[model samples]
Target: MPEAPEADLAGFVRAHDPDRFLCTLFAPAAARPALFALTAFNHELARAREAASNPIAAQIRLQWWRDAVEEAAAGRPARRHEVATPLATAIGAGLLDPAALLAMIEAREAETEEDGLETEQDFVAWLRGTSGGWSAAAGRALGADPEAAEVLRALGAAYGLAGVLRSVPAHAARGRCLLPRDRLAATGLSAESVVATPHAPTVGALAAEMAAEGLEALRGARRDIPRGAVAAALPAVLAARDLMRLAAGREVPAPRGIGDRLAVTLAGLRGRV
Candidate 1:
C-alpha cells in the first residue's frame, strides 16, 4: 500500500488552524485525512497575501497553486509541497473537486486586490466564495445530501465574517481592513481610523455591528442544516461564540481553553457545531 500522506500536514493544520483541526476530529476516521488536507489547503490560501511582500508576488503564489490544481485534474504528477501532495491524494480519492478548489484559489486572489471591503454585499460575496466554499466542500466530502449545501454556505459565511472581524487589529497593522467601508464611513470612521484606534468606542461599535451580521447568518445556518451535515459545520459554533463575546464588549476570545474545549466537544457529540 502507498505510504500515508505525511502526518506533517495535519500537524501544520493543528498548529495554525486549531479550531478546524478540532472539528476534523469529529469527522469519521475515513474522512479525517481529506478534511485535514482540505483545511490545510485553505490555510495556505488564506495566508498567501500576508506571506508576500507585494501584490504581484501574492498573485504568483496563488497562480502556482492554481496550476497545481489544474495539473492534478489532468492526471499529472502531484507537486512535492507539504499541503499540495496530500491535496492531490484527496483529489485522487475522489474526495474533493478540482473545480471547487480552483474557485477557492480565485477567491483568495480577488481578496489580494482589495485594500478593504467597500460594501456589505461585497463582504458577503467574498465570504460566500471563500469560507462558504470550504464548508460546502467539507459537506460534499462527508457525503452530505445535496440539499445541505446552502446551509453549509450560510454557516461558513457567518464563521468567515466573525474571523475577519476578530482579525481587525492584525489586518489593520498590515494596512488592510476587512470591515465594510461604507458602514464605517456612515459612523464617521474609516479604515485608517480603525487601525489608528482599534480600541476606541467607535471601532468597538463597528465591531459589534459586524458581529451582529454574523449572528444573523448563524441563525439561518442553524435553521437549515440537516443532522448529517452538522459535524461538517462545527466551526460555526466557534464563530458564534466569538461574535457573542465581541457583542458583549469583550476582545475576541482566544483559542479553546479547558472549559471551552469541553463545550465544543459536547456540542460536537450532539451534532450541533
Candidate 2:
C-alpha cells in the first residue's frame, strides 16, 4: 500500500516542493525515513532562496545556506539549522551525498544572483547545470548506474530547458528573461518587445518550439528510468512540463494555481502507477 504523506518528514518535504516530492517513488519503505528527512532538509535550505521576500534577505539567507552546506562538508555541524540534524542523520544512514547536497545549495546560490542570461546557449547551460544538476542528484539517490546517470542527466537537462521555455512569459513579466537575447534577436524580438507584447504569434511559436525540444529530450530519456516505484513518477514529470506549456500559452506571471495543478498531476501519477 502507498504510505501516508505524513509518514516521517514526507509532509515536510512536500512543503518545499509538492511537485518534486513525487520523485521519491523508488525509495524503499525502509529508506523513507532517511529519504524524507534528507529531502525535507534540502527543501528547507532551498526555501531560503525561493521564499526570500527581498533581494537583500534572499542573499543573506542563501549565504547562510551556503555556509551550512560548507560546514556540513567540513564535518562541522551547525545547531541553528533544523534541517541539518535530520540531514546529518540521513548522512549517517548512507542516505545522503554531501557533494550532491552542496551542489544543490550552489545552484540556489546562483539562482539568487541576477546573472544576465544573454543568449539561448547561456540559458540552456544554466538550466542544465542547475535544475538539471538536481536531476543528476536524484539519479544518484536511485542507485543509478553510469549509463542510467548519463540518461538521467540528459533528461534533467531537457526538463531544465523545458522549464525555462515554459517560464518565458512568467520570467518576462518579472523583468527576467530565461531565453537568450541572441535568439530573441534572431526572431526580431527584443527582450523589451517580449514583455510589452499583447501576445505575439511569433513569441508563442518560439515558446512552443522550445517546449517541443524539451519534450523530445524527455521522451528520449524515458526508457532510461527503471520500472517499479521509480517509474511511478514519470507521469508527474510529464504533467509538470505540460503545465509549463499551459502557463506559456497564458503568459501568466505565476504559472498555474497549485491546488488545481496538484489534483491533475497527482491523478495522472496515480493512474500511471
Candidate 3:
C-alpha cells in the first residue's frame, strides 16, 4: 500500500466528526482507505471555502475545487492541489465512484454561489445532489450490487437532509439560507428575518418539514438494500433523524446543534455494526 498522506485520511476520519465516522463504520473494509481520502478531501474543501480571507477569493477557490473534482471524474487528477493528492489516490482505487463525487462537488459549488434558495425544488435538488451524493458514494463502496447502491444512496440522503435541517440556524448566520425562500415567503417569513433572528418559529417549522420528507424517502430506500448493511447504517441515520426531530422542536443550538444527537449516532453505529 502507498504510504499514508501527510493528512493521514484514516486518522482524520476516526478523530473528527462523530456523524461521519459513525456512517463510515458500515463501509466495507476494502473501501475504507479510499473512502477516508475522499471524505478528507471534501472536509478540507468545505472548510477552505468558508475560511478564505477574501470572499471573492473564496468563491474563486471554490470554483477551482469544483474543477478539481471534475478532473477526478474525468480520470485525470489535478496535479498541484493539496487535497487533490489523496482524492486522486481514492479515485485510483476504482471504488470512489466518480459520478457521486462529481455531483457532490457541483452541488457544493452552487451552495457557495447562491444568495438564497429561490425555490423549494432548488433546495431539494441541492440536498439530494450533495448529501445524497455522499450517501451514494458510501453505498457504492460497501454494496455488492447496483440495487444495493441505490438504496444506500437514498438512506444517505435521508440522513444528510436531517443534518442540513438541523444546521439551518448556522447557515443563516453565514448569510446563506438553505431553506427555500419561496416556501418561507409562503409562510410570511422573509429571508432577512431569518438572518436577523435565526431562531424564528417559521425556520423551525421548515426544518421539521424537510426532516419529515427525508424520513419518508429513507423508508422507501430501506426496502431495497441488503438487511445487513441497512441494519448497520440505520442506527446512525436514526440518531440523525432524532436530531432533526429535536431541531424541529426548537431544542438544539446552531450548526453544531446536532452535537448530542451525533453522540447517539456514534453509539448506535458501533453497537449495531
Candidate 4:
C-alpha cells in the first residue's frame, strides 16, 4: 500500500477535509493525531468510489479498509500504510471504536448501488452510519460518555444530510442521486431526472426544503453536547452554514471565508456548536 504522502496526517486533513482540520485546531494536542487519522480515514472512504474504475473496484477498496479495521480490532499491526498506522494506534489506545469505523466503511457501500435512497428513512439511516458514526466516534475520542456520544451521532446525521445536498451536482456528474427517490418524485423529479437536470427549479425547491429540515435538526442539537465534547460537534455549525447557503441558492463546498473561520473559532471558544 502506498504510504500517506508524509507522516503528517494533518497535511492530508488540511488539504482534503479542511472543515475537520479547522475543528482539529480546537482539539487537545495529544488527541489531534487520532483526529487526523480518523479524518483521513473518512476522506479515503468518501473518495473511494470516485477513485475506483468501477463499482466492483470501489467495493474491493472499501473491503480493504474493512479488513484493516478488523486487523486493528484484533490488536494486530495494521500499520503498513499511513492511515492504518495511526488508525491502529488510535484503536490500540482505545480512543476509537472499531465498531464505529466498521459502520462508516459499511455505509459507503450505498454509493456502489444503482438504486438510490428509496425513502427519507433510507437517507437518514445511511447518514446514521456514515457521518453519524464518525461524529460519535470523534465525540468519544474527545471524552464524551455514551449519552453525549449518541447525541453527537444524531447531530452528525444532520450534518451528513447537508453534505449530501452540497454534493448534488457532483453525484449527478456520476449519474447518481443521493436524495430520497420518493422526495425527488414529490418534486416531479425521478432518479434519472435528477441525474439529467440536477439544477432544475423543482430540484432546487426540494433541496431547499431538505436544507430547512437540516437547519431545524441543528437547532434541536444545541445544548446536547457538553463543553468537553464540543469540538466534535462543531461540524454542526458548518452544517448549519451550508444549509443556509443551500437555501440562498449558493453552491456549497465553496471556499470558506475569514468570517466562517471566525465563526467556528468563536463557537469553539464558547464551547458550543
lDDT against the true structure, each candidate: 0.81, 0.58, 0.62, 0.85
| lDDT digits (tens) for residues 1-273 of candidate 4 | 555543478897898989889987888888888888899999889888889888899999999999998999999877688788888888999988899899899889987776867898888989988888888899999999888988988888888988889888788998778898888887788989988998888888889888987887778764568787787888888888888988777777467888778889999999987
Candidate 2, position 217, lDDT = 54
Best-to-worst lDDT order: 4, 1, 3, 2
Give per-residue lDDT, candidate 2, residue 72. 60
Using all chains and alpha carbons, the TM-scores for the candidates as numbered come to 0.93, 0.71, 0.77, 0.94
lDDT of 1 by residue, 139-223 (tens): 8888876668767877887789888878888887887777778888999998888888777888888888778867866765554
**lDDT score for residue 226 of model 1:** 61
Sliding window of 10 residues with minimal summed lDDT for model 3: 227-236
Candidate 2 on 1-273: residue-level lDDT in tens?
222334545766666655456556445556555556555655665456457765568778766656665666566754444466666655655556677676666655555556446767766666655656555555556566656655555656665665566666666766655566787888887777877762678888777766656665565555445543342234336444564554356442343467545554464455332
Question: How many backbone clashes can be found in candidate 3?
Answer: 0
Better of 2 and 3 by TM-score: 3
Best by TM-score: 4
Which ranges of candidate 2 are over 4 A from the true structure?
A: 1-8, 33-59, 108-115, 197-200, 226-273
Compared with the true structure, what per-residue lDDT tens digits does model 3 show for residues 98-201? 66676676676665553656888887777666656665666566553677666555565566566666666777777656677888898888778887877877
Question: Judged by lDDT against the true structure, how good is candidate 3?
Answer: 0.62
C-alpha displacement of 268 in model 3, angstroms?
A: 7.9
Candidate 3: where are CA atoms >4 Å away? 1-7, 52-59, 70-82, 227-236, 247-273
At residue 106, give the lDDT of candidate 1.
83
TM-score: which is higher, 2 or 4? Answer: 4
